[model samples]
Target: MEINRRDFITKMSAIAALSVLPSSFVAAMGNEKVEKAKPKYPTLKCDVVVVGAGPGGVPAAIAAARQGAKVILLEEDNMPGGAPVDMYVPFICGGPRVGVFQEMIQVLNAKHTIGGRTCETFGKTGSDGKNHWWMPGSYAEVIYQLLEKEENITLMCAAPVVGVKVKTSGNRNQVTGVRIMRNGDYQDIDAAVTIDATGNGLIADMAGCEYMFGSEAKSDYNEPVGIEVADGKVQPCTWMLISERIKRNAILPIDKLKGSSAVEDNLNRWVKADDKEDMIRRDAGIYLHWGRTVYCKDTRDPLLLAQAQQEALERLQENLEIWHEAGYAVHLAPKLGVREVRRIKGEYVLTANDLIAGTMHDDVIAHAHYSFDVWGMKIPEEMKHIGPYGIPYRSILPTKTEGLLTAGRIISATRIAHSSLRVQPICSNIGMAAGTAAAMSALNQTGLRSIDIKQLQDRLASMGLFDGLKKK
Candidate 1:
């Protein structure tokens, strides 16, 4: 009996879903709802595919490759280094001391691009001590070279992932591949496992995974740092700029400026940069204090983006003029420093309590040591502690999505918990864990949830990471 094209396609999709879905999902499919049409596109197959070649995506690709998987890394930008190159956020926090973090510090030191510890505002060293800093150019270049050294990793730039190919079986949805735009055409790339290191939860959102944006109420997660009401309001994003000191004589007189008297009034107050201790501490000419912030929730709105950018530019222009008198010219940041965005709901949602307690989990794969640093938001009492939190393997696992895991700032965490984990070093560590887990899942022909947590932890330990978990 000949079947109709629609029927045939439906049957084929079921077969594909059955081939890849976990046992639990397959068992639940008997009573599952309607079957949907499978996507059709030009295809490429790989062991694993990672989206967004930022700080997280880069390390993720490298980790999967080092695990002997054929990996493809997709980036929307022409180059990698999403934050450093695109966002111009040159700060690398003291998060992880091991694994890729150590390698990065060593590389920066060897290249002489590592700036010694810097003090708060005006470049003055704080009594609390200084933290390491590096030029974005050097950091991006080193990351590129590192990716190049990995034979198993294929880096694709200017390829933005637009959609996800999900095969739903029973209660679970498995991401078979991602639909990406390439050379003005859409194409499908299949993978056994896909890592969402986009840092904005873009892949997870497209995959129909459960996620939350902004803030959650304290009662929701029993979070001390949560707000009284869940309003999704998060810390604002900053537009950072680079500057260089020039001779003071290069500055034009305030009377020669073209602006309202109100603008001039503010400029007069802000231009006193010569002896202000608030302005003189850093060796790098980059000004951290001179930033205009817009909420992350409003970041994607075109009108909001335009308005925020204009405000940021106007503020930057004023700072430039002020610095011009103090001998500094400005270089604007390429992208805004977005502090928070979509927090994908994962198998385990880490909370502020866990971070403050430095809770250890048996399945821990990575570690983050950073203070709960929230910009433009009240720091709750629970977030005030200095912590070395153990990030478990479950933190990156999407709650209902099979064949997918998260890395970077997009991992499963409460808004307050994320404030600490979103730093560069911690994100890189999470990337390595996600990549390693993806490789294992692909090689074992198992869904990401089926991979043995202990085995994954063991692999990380062998890689000279996850040692912190031993103490617990």
Candidate 2:
């Protein structure tokens, strides 16, 4: 009761220090110190683990499951459909949309066509050249139906892969599986083959695999088309949205909008005099609009992405007012449409030359046929629409990494080459190839590189994946 001021201060500091300590240690203040235990995460085993249930991951999961591998498909979002469901990018851009992708598109065309056009050609290339897109929710429905049919696939939604379980030795990494966040704790999902289909190459990057981000100079890769000097700049992010005609008989204000494009359900640009009457007669109320595009300071950073989205929304206010006056309501996407991210380094980095020359690699796993559609850069007119080119099996196999494969737009490719193959169809095909290879590797108990390329090619060929290459 007669404590001095100095003693009181000293005693308070000691109590503060003890308060920050663990309860067990604090309880043993004058006794033997207790050691803190390391956190133990629940571990789940599977034959193959596919992260990100977007265009690439979904197909990868389905393909692997079809090949008799137990697949655990994880999606960060609550639903499975990737860009289409999440980003409102429901339009199909690239071609050679065969294999599991073709199947999905066929289902979308038959059941989910919003343009009031009957699709006569089922599983036909390009759906008989009829450009079409579905409502974003339709894509989710179709994906759920397709995924449900697969008995060997376990679809886990709202599960994000936060880390990779990698074994490293002398600059070489063997990805055993991935760790996901679960119930405020970490849960490990071990697999024989792990597919980095996160679209950002997050898992591969975490696994200590080398990755290329942003633009590389033309001289660096000897690419046919790219900037002379490397800029490390990625394509601008777009905020995609859909506008619906709310009021009856209200004409779409396409001419007044400066940045947005009003398209028909068939994805055909709405021409003023050419098809206005026909469009109104069809009662096509919904139109996909490219809301606003802005370059993010650093796309890899979530905060930067959010800032870019805010900037886009600010820029979109004028368009939003215009649409409201035109009796239309807009539905913005859940996330910004990111065009590029980490392109994980692989055995072979595909270049624009390969796309232009239509190089059919000996181990071609997928054929991508799309125009060079660089958002910020202007490609030559002739170089715009190149012939069908092959995506080799080597391109999906990350260099110096075993049991890990890259899928979607994250596969190794120069910026110019990525502009061509980064679309949904091409990505889906790549996912199919990656999934099949993953299944093969898991079932055979062999390394990814040691798998039979010839057999893989034959399997893809049988699925009509090579049909596009044959047409050329």
Candidate 3:
């Protein structure tokens, strides 16, 4: 006779106790079946849960903690630093790097700078006009120190969020927390508010939230620039590396490299350099190089990404030999620099027009200043350096989702707008806003969308988040 699942389990449990009985009695029940053990998931509760402790998530967690919220910062990697540590993208691109991002950079400039001149004025926004990059491990060191200082933050590294815990109510999904893979079993961390700072919108995507992937046609968002038709293309993946001179006085073979630009440290800004030799001579101990770039068949797929990385490595063989012959050792990044992924659709989808016009929204929480630097897409030189634009609060709130917020480059924006704000500093600022907002939602027992916008703005402003843009 067939037994129900519960009854079967109960009977199997009773049979398990039969091991203490006589062998004859146990043997008589040989036809009894035993069920395989199922994995048990442990549950945890917190005020705020921030996933992906990179530039964005770190600040988000810190901001929430500072607001008196018990924050749990989850990172899939063993350490906290995001792209800079994992992907070796230690280069700083866009500007107005204020708030928690500014704090980290200040520490980086003071203690971790490899080639740049010593920063006399800490926390100043590009006043020195010096560009700097630290060793990849330096970022991790600084991030760890910053996170450790926050009393309310519980950081969990190597905790990958495999699933999202949500409560569904008619078309809307309210995110409660996340399920992370831990010790071969699932552990759920339930929080009042969840922030998706995964940079790829992984949490939001897992929560059944609608998201946009790939390039959208110019007509889709009515942006000023973009292709006429949606090409389903994205920015190419770059494999970055740091090269150091193993032998004393060995020159970097910049001229021999093809398709890769050898970026020497802060002698002169590499962005607009007229004399490469002069810049190299000023400071040349270490150099950051864009090793190789390749277009993945599908960036969202792990197999395709691996294949693309293999292709990039194949292309970089000649350069690797060149560097080795020059007595330089190259440290390849642990992961490929993926530029784009899922963009969760929010209440306001930022577009190129918002950036071009520098629209200052009433609910502006963060300010981003960067040019349209979409890889593989050619933009007019004149339109490249647009003025600072505002990132509204609505842009971080995923559509129809409660108790959840989007942070980093994955926040709501068209592809054109994303290309600019996707940089580290801007992403950090956005994360700070998301974290602060999340804390408010958790403590006040209010929905993410129902929080007072003015209060959020005031809190952000007090934190120096609004210092980047001069309000009109």
Candidate 4:
């Protein structure tokens, strides 16, 4: 007799619960101690394998599952929700309502508000908008529940993809399978299609696809803005800390706290400074400017990342104690808010010119309404506040790699353009398209480039997305 997935999960959970029982409890039951057996691992196969499970990968997994494809969502963290929930980003950024962004607003009960305060104009007109403030941990639960409803989707947390198996066909290479590390055991996942929503293009790198890192030369795309040569000084990562006001309590001064001397000095200076941003208020007793910007050569480097995390925690601890004395409860997020990283070299590379001119392409799959909001880079004043532009399907397609597609911040775009499209809503849109494309490719036994673009657009339209892509 065959068992269903639900039954398997229930039995596994029961075994897990029993394994953790106290020795005394087992002895009380008069059961003899038995030697434990080694864990059994099995090879898994799926129609689609999506890595990252962040804002982008979550939707990708759901979209593929909705298409009746078996999907494996691999995440490095214990849960989904990506930067918005993990890093405690207060609200989703303003964008056109379509696709997952529209669905998420309805499902998550998101309210259109500014700075957590109600605004009739912005809410009614629905121009520039942000969701009402929410805790990341709570929002993570919402994302988890959403994924759980998809019977075809299997979400594995803390299971990182260690390798991508690739095979060369004549001149180009194709991904065959992937190796995953889960609980000191290696598991192989063979998929018909792979989606690289890893934010930093980790799978693409493992597949040996051509990719770009940091900023590109202004001459390369030529719309003006950004560094002249490729460099690692793309954007500074931020650590967001949350705080709430309460009754006053006894606490020590900020100097005695175990914080970086430089951070402590900055706090001391801010105390006496009169020209601080509105993010800090004396009456509020809680500061939102607690998030710190840190410059690191490589955000992926374990040593550098650890240092950044340590610095963030120290700053958080120092502020929490200071705020505690002033009647506030402050806490820091466990994840770092990374902005920019690796971008796959796709069939078409969207540039700042495309964004500035609001260019529409023949293969437009989605649209973005944002500017080149690059931080830590020298962006020209004229390059600011660009209007809506269409994102091409070719931009998400790898140039020489087959059987794979990349979305989210890893999509093909110029450095200036990435800063605009790297937000949650836009990334979700890209993920939806990628997932659909992957599903179609898997079902038809075709490569990504061979998928019927018009048919894919029609499917998206039926699902109430891809309004920007008009059928010819």
Flag clash pairs in model 4.
none
Residue 396's lDDT in candidate 2: 95
lDDT (tens digit, per residue) of candidate 1 on 136-240: 677678778888899999889998886676776655678887777777666678899989898788777666667777777888888767578877676777776
Regarding TM-score, does 2 or 3 come out ahead?
3
Alpha carbon deviation, residue 360, candidate 4 (Å): 1.8
Model 4 is weakest, by summed lDDT over 10 consecutive residues, at 22-31
- Write the residue-wise lDDT of candidate 3 on 220-271 in tens digits: 8888798898888889999999888898888776767777855655453452
Instruction: Please report the TM-score between candidate 2 and the true structure.
Output: 0.87
- Lowest lDDT 10-mer window, candidate 2? 26-35
Q: After superposition, how far is residue 464 of candidate 3 from its true place, in Å?
A: 0.9
Which lDDT tens digits does candidate 4 get at residues 1-472?
A: 1111242233334544565322111110111221121214686889999988887798888888888889999987887877877676645553545665556555454432213434222232222333344556656767777887889999998887776655554435577666676787667778889898988887776665667767777787785776676664557777876655567542223333332122111121222232234224323343333366676677656688778777766656655566677665666677777787678889999888898888979887776666678877756677787857877999999887788899888888887888888877678878887898899999788888989999988877676665522310
| Candidate 2: C-alpha RMSD after superposition | 10.5
TM-score of 3: 0.88
lDDT of 2 by residue, 190-225 (tens): 899999888887777666567788888998878878
- By summed lDDT, the worst window of 10 consecutive residues in model 1 runs over 260-269
Local lDDT at 212 for model 3: 79
Candidates in order, TM-scores: namely 0.80, 0.87, 0.88, 0.79
The numbered model that scores best in lDDT is 3
